[model samples]
Target: MSTIQKDSAITLHFTIKLNDGSVADSTHNMGKPAKLIIGDGSLSDNFEQCLIGLTSGENKSIELKAQDAFGMPNPDNVHYMDRAKFVGDAEVEVGTVMAFSGPDGAEIPGIITDIAGDSVTVDFNHPLAGQDVTFDVEILSVE
Candidate 1:
């Protein structure tokens, strides 16, 4: 039974829930476990810290503050792009999620929170930002 530590490869099933007990994300719903290596950039350091020392078959519900989970939303992350930038049938309506190219060629997903006249407000903040969250994790394996 290996404990989760730096550089350890881990497989786990987890769900992210909000303070209201509303689920934000869940691998359980997807019917698949998530696999990741510790120290990888896939998860925030604060999130990964909660998994330390957990062995196989262990489960825990770890609560995190807004800043610790996803951090408070940054006003700078909200940008108003020209409606024309949406192109044909790109779904620019409010609540639509779209992917935009990042500086390093990564696909950054943004949500359209508002549409006003010729401006479409796209928020690049993580959807759960500014909300406290709980991680319900079931450790499947650790290596």
Candidate 2:
């Protein structure tokens, strides 16, 4: 009978839906739950706030704004890289997702925004950036 609080290990089945009620992601379909350590950096503070008071076997839905969700897309996040970088056989087509090294040594997954002549434009922004999303959570366990 543990309560969900900061530093709690929470297990939940969740479905992320858009404002239009379109399912973006769902763990319920997989028949397995996901666990998140409260206060972890994996989730934003706003997202964590929504789960702070939930108990086991609870169901809740929370709405998140663009900023509170994936955050607003920054113009600077979009970059144009040399086409030579993509020497592999994978089609360098627009809308393709690729991973590139970031300044912090993390692989930043970027979307191929454009491909012209010798320059292949890549956007390093999160795919869901600037999008307002909703989280539909079913608290499977809280400890």
Name the candidate that leads on lDDT: 1
Candidate 2 lDDT over 1-143, as tens digits, reads 77789999999988988878888778977878899899988788999989998899888989999898889999999998898889877789999998888889998899999999999989888888888899988898888
User: What is candidate 1's lDDT per residue for 93-113, written digit by digit as tens?
Assistant: 899999999889999999999
Model 2 ranges with Cα > 4 A deviation? 29-31
Location of the lowest summed lDDT over 10 successive residues in candidate 2: 22-31
Error of 1 at 116 (Å): 1.3
The best candidate by TM-score is 1
lDDT of each: 0.93, 0.89
Deviation (Å) of 37 in candidate 1:
1.1
Question: Which 10 consecutive positions of candidate 1 have the poorest summed lDDT?
Answer: 84-93
Clash pairs, candidate 1, are none
